[model samples]
Target: MLDTLSLYVAAPEILLLVMSCAIALIDLGVQTRLRNLTYGLTVATLVGVTWLCVEFALEGQTIYAFGGMVVSDPLGNWLKAFAAVAVLVTLVYGRPYAADRDMLRGGELFTLSLFSLLGMFVMISGSNFLVIYLGLELLTLSSYALVALRRDNANATEAAMKYFVLGAMASGFLLYGLSMLYGATGSLDLDQVFQAIASGRIRHEVLVFGLVFIVAGLAFKLGAVPFHMWVPDVYQGAPTAVTLLIGSAPELAAFAIAIRLLVEGMMPLAIDWQQMLIVLAVGSLLVGNLAAIAQTNLKRMLAYSTIAQMGFVILGLATGFVNGSTANAQYAYSASMFYVVTYVLTTLATFGVILLLAREGFESEEISDLSGLNQRSPLYAGIMAVCMFSLAGVPPLVGFYAKLTVLQALVASGQAFHIGLAVVAVMLSLIGAFYYLRVVKVMYFDAPLTATTVSAPADVRAVLTLNGALVLILGILPGGLMALCADAVLRTLAG
Candidate 1:
C-alpha cells in the first residue's frame, strides 16, 4: 500500500530520527564538561537533515507518504530546512551559556532539543488531523520539560506548570475542533476534508463552530493575544539558553502548521477563519506593542515583541483569502512566510547577544544590563543594534520589507476594511518601534555596568556575525527569498 519512493520522500525525517536516538545513546558515555562528542554528532546530524531538506525542496515535487498522512512539499521542506538551521544556531549560541549555569551536566538539553526538532518535522508534514495533534503533543511535552530543565529553579518549575496546564487546554480545543470537522465531513485526512468542505455539503453552522476552537488553538501556539499569557512568564523564567531555543526555531514549525491547517486544508472556509485572524491580529498588535513599552526585563519585552510580530504574520494570512477568493492567496501567504523567516533570523541574533552577556550567577534579564554595550564590545553591540533595527522595521533591514509585503498584500485586496487594517497595522508598528529603538538607545548611549569585555566561543562569534549580516543583506536583496516563498506557495496550491 506504500509507494517505493515514500522512503526517499521521508529520508530527512528518517535520518533525523535515527541520528537523534543514536546521539542520546552516545551521550550517556560522554563525560567531557562540554560534551564535545555529543555536540559534534548532534550538529552533524542537523546539518545532514538541513542539507536533505534543502535538496528535496529544490526538487520541487510534492510526495504523499504513509497513505497520505504525511506530505513532502517544497514549502514543508524549506521550512524544515530553516528549522534545522535555527536549532543549529541556537545550540551554537546556547551551549556556552548552558555550561556556565551547569545545565550541561547532562545530555538532556541536546537530546530534548533534537527530539523537539523531530516533533516540528512531523507537525510540518502531517497531512492528517490525529497525526498533527500527536506531533503537537510531542513538541509541547518536550518544551515543558525543557522549560523545567532547571529543576532547582523555582521560577522554571512554576513556568513549566503554567505552560503545561494552559497548553493542555489549548490542545483539547484543537482536538475538539478536529473532531467536529471529522464528524461533519466524515474524514480525518486533510485532503479528503478539503474535498468535503469544498463540496459545500457540510452544514455551515457546524463548520463555523468547529473553526472557532481550531483558530483559538492555533493562536495560542503562535503566542497571539488572549492566549499569549504564558509567553512572557516562560521566556523570563526559563534559562536564557532555553528561552532562545524556544523563541527562535519552533516558530517556523508553528507557521507551517498554520499553513497546513488553515490554508491548505480549510481554504474553503477562509471567509469564516480570516475574520477570526483579523480580530486576533488587531488584538495582538494593540496589546503586544503597548504592554512591551512598560517592560524593563529584556526577555519579557522581546516576548511581547514576538506577539506583535506575529500580528503582521496573521494579517498576511488574513488578507490571502479575501471575499472567498484564492486569487491572492499565494502572494499574501508568501509575505507571511518571509515575515516569519526573517523574524526568526533577527530573534536568533538578539537572543544570542543576551545569552552571551549572561555570566555566572548574573542573569542579563534587565534592560539596564545592556547599558553602554558599545563601550564593552562593539562587535556584539553592533550585532544587537542590527537586530533591533530589523525588528523595528527600519529600511534596508529584512523586517521592513517583511512588513511592507504584507501591507502590499492587504492593499492589493482593494477592500476598504483591509486598507483600513493596513493603516492600523502601520500605526501599531510605529508604536512597536519605540521599544525596539529604546533597546538600541540604551546599548549605545548608557554607561557600561561592567568594564569587562564580552566574549563568545569562536563558533558562536562566526555564526552570530553571519546572522546579523544576513538581516541587513537580505533586506537589500529580498527578491530571492520572496521569489522562493512565492514559488513554494504556488507549488503547494498546485499540488
Candidate 2:
C-alpha cells in the first residue's frame, strides 16, 4: 500500500483528481444560478496545483513513481506549470461565452478539462511507451468530448466526428509502432529501448519501422503538413474555449512526448530520424504558412500558424546538434522551447481578444468582422494589435526573439541545405506577417460593418488585458524565461 501510494507521486495530479470529483458532485446538486461555482472551484484547484508545481521546480527533486512509469523532473515541472497557466486563462476567457450560450453548467466540461490536464501531467512525466500511450488516449478522449460540448450545433457535431475518426487512426498507428518497438527491444521503457538500440540488441529493420510509425503518429498530433488536414476545420467548428485549450495545452503535451521519444527513446537512431524530421519540417513550414495567407477566418488562420510553428520546433530538434561541445546544440534546444512559450502567449492573447469581441449572437471571428475595431473598442483593438504584431514576429515582441533563436540555432549547426531551408522559413515568416498585419489594418483603418456597441464582460477584459500585457513584458525581459526554457531543455537532454 505504501508503494502504491508512492506511485501517485505528483501533488498536482492528486489535487486535480480530488477537485474534479468534488466539482462534479457540486455541479450535479447546485442550483442553476450557482453554475459559475464550478468555474471558481476549477480555477482554485488550478492555482493550487500551479503553486505546488512551482514548489517542486524550486526544490528540484526527481520523483519516480509506478516503478519508473512516471517521473517528475524540471522539464515536467515547468511544462505543468505552463499548462496550468494556460488552462486558467482559457477558463477566464471561456466563462462568459459559455454563460451567454447556456452551455456553462453541469461540470461536464470542467471535469473533462481537469482530466485532460491530468493526462497532460502523465504525458510530460511518462518514462515508458505504455504510460505515454495511456496519457495520450486520456487527453484525446477528453478533447473529443470537449469539441462536441455544443451538441446542438451541427458544425460542432461534424467537427467532433472528424476529429474522432482522424484521432483514432493516428492512435492505431501509434500503438502498432509501440508494439513493434516492444517486440524488437523486448522492453517498454523508453530508457531501456535506447539502451537496447545502443547495445545492438534490437533488430534494425523492426526498430526503423517502429520509429517511422511513432513519428507519424506524433506528427499528426503536432498538426504538421501532411497530417494537419483536420486542424482548421476542428478549430473553426469547435467552441472558441475548446479551441483555446486544444491550441495551447495539447501542443505542449506533444512537445514533451517528442522530447521523450526522440531524445531518450531514439537517441541511437538520431541520424535517421533527424533526416526525416527535416523533410517534415520544411514541408510543414511551406504548406502551413502559404495556406494561412488565404484564410478569411481568424481561427482558421491561427490553425495554420500553429502548423507553421510546429515546423520550426521540429526543425530545431532535427539538427542532430545535441552531442557537440559547441553552443549550437544549446541554442537549438533553447530556440525550440522559446518558440513554444512565445506561441502559447501569442495564441492565448489572440483568442482572448476574439472572446472579448464576440457578443450574444455574433462571434466576431471573421476577418471582415474586425473592421473599425479601433473606433468601437480602443482597448480591445490595442490588445489585438499587440497580439497581431507578436504573431507577425515583429521586433520588441516575444515572437521575434523566438524566431531569431530558431534561425540562429539552425544556421549555427546546419549544413548548406539546412541553411537554405532556414532561409525559406524566414521568407515564410514574412508572408505570414502580411496576413496577421492585414487583420490589424482592418481593425484600425476600415469602417465598421454595423453600429452595434462593442463591449466585453469585466472578467473577459481582465484576462485579455493580462495576456496582452504579458506579451509585451516577456518581449522586453525575455532573458529570465529564456534561461528557464534553456534549463528545462538542458535537464531533459541530460537525462
Candidate 3:
C-alpha cells in the first residue's frame, strides 16, 4: 500500500518485477525449443522499463520513495535505462549461444536475466545502507544462479561455487561494515549516517575500521586487486553468453552502488577511502595488464582486461575529492561514469563476437580459435577489431575518449602524486594495448583454423553490427553521452 508519488518514483522497478514474474510463469507453458514467446515477453518488458527510465531521467527530478530508502534521480534513471538496454542486447546475443548449448531448455536464461536486471535496478535506486545491501544480495545471488545454470558443465559448476563462496564472503564484509557504521552513527539511513559523520561526534578509529571492510567489499565487487581472485575464474569458466551478461550490465550497478555508498554516504571520510581506492587502482592496473599478456585463453584475457578497465574507473573515483575541496567532484565522477558506460558498450560487442563464433560442441575458448577470423567474416572481425582498438585507447574509438576523460580527471587534480599516477596509467595502458593488439594480429595474420564461414541469426547480425558501429560513432561524437553523465552527476550532487 504505497501512495501515488511513491508508486510513481518506483514505477519502472515495479513494472519490471511483475513482468519478470509473469514471463517466468509463462515460460512454464512454453514448449518451443526456442522459447520465442518467453523471450518476446522479456524483451517487451525490458523495453517498457527502459522507456520508463528514460522518461524519468528526462524529467530530471529527484524523488525519494519508500520512506526515503529508495531514490529516483537523473543519475539512477540513466544508469537503469542503460542497464536495461545492455540486458536486452545481451539476451539478443546470448540466445543462439545458449540455445546451442541447451542452456535455454527451460527459458531460464531469459527469466534469470530479467531477475538479475531487477537486482540491478534496485541497486541503482537504493538510498539506504540496508536497501543497498539488499539490492547487492539480490544481484549477486541471481548471478550465482546464472553461473550455475548449466549444472552439468563442470567448469560452470566450479565457477558458480567460487562465485557463491567469495560472493558470500564479500556480502558478509559489506554487511559487517554497515553494521559497524550503524553502531557508530546509530542510523541505517544514508542521509542520517552522512549527517552523523559530518557532525564528527563518532570515533574516527571505529569509522576507519568499518571503512576498511567497506572498501574491501567494494573493491571485490569492482574486481580490483587483492580481492579479485574470482574475476578471471568466473569469466573464463562461465558460458560466453553468461559471461557477457555478468561482465557488461552489472558494472553499471556496481558503479552506482560505489557512488551511493562512498561518494554520497561517506564523503565526510573522503581522504581515508580515497587512499584505499588509489592503492587498489594502481594494483589493478599493473596486475591486470601484465596478467592479460600472459593469458592464452581469450575469455581469460578479456577478464583481465576488464580488471584493467575497472582500474581506470577507480582512478576517476579516487580523484573526485582533492585536498578537501569538492569543487572538481562532479567532473571527476562524471568521467568515471562515462568510462564505465563506454566500457560496457565495448564489452557487449566484444563478447558478442565471441559468442557468435562458438558452435554446439566446440567452445571457442582459446586465443588460437580466433585465428584468421578476418578471413572468415570481415564484418565481425572488423567489429572485434574495433572493440580491441577501443579497449587499447586508440583514437576515434569510444575507449580512447573514456580513458582520456579519466586521465584528464587525474591530471586536473593538480597534485604531483595524481599526475604521477596518470603517467603510470599511460604506461600501463601501453602494456594493455599489446595484449589487445595480439588478438587483432591473430585475427588478421594467422591462418584459419577451419574453412567454415561464420554465420549468425539475422537479428544477432543486425544488432551486433549496430552495437559495433556505436562504439565508433560514439567515439567520433562522444559529447552527447559525456554531457549526459556530467549533468546527471551535477543533479545528483545538487540534490
Tens digits of per-residue lDDT, candidate 3, 226-289, equal: 8899999999989898999999999999999999999889999999999999999999999999
Runs of candidate 3 with Cα error greater than 4 angstroms are none
What RMSD value applies to candidate 3?
0.8
lDDT of 2 at 447: 99
lDDT of 1 by residue, 123-178 (tens): 99999998888888888999999999988889999989998999999999999999
lDDT of 3 at 159: 98
lDDT top scorer: 3
For all predicted structures, in order, the TM-scores are 0.99, 0.96, 0.99
RMSD per model, one decimal = 0.9, 1.7, 0.8
Range of the 10 consecutive residues with the lowest summed lDDT in candidate 1:
1-10
Counting clashing residue pairs in each candidate, in order, gives: 0, 0, 0
Give stretches of model 2 more than 4 Å off: 4-8, 320-327
- Specify the poorest-scoring 10-residue window by lDDT in model 2: 320-329
TM-score of 1: 0.99
Q: Per-model C-alpha lDDT, please?
A: 0.92, 0.84, 0.94
Candidate 3 clashing pairs, residues 3+ apart or interchain: none
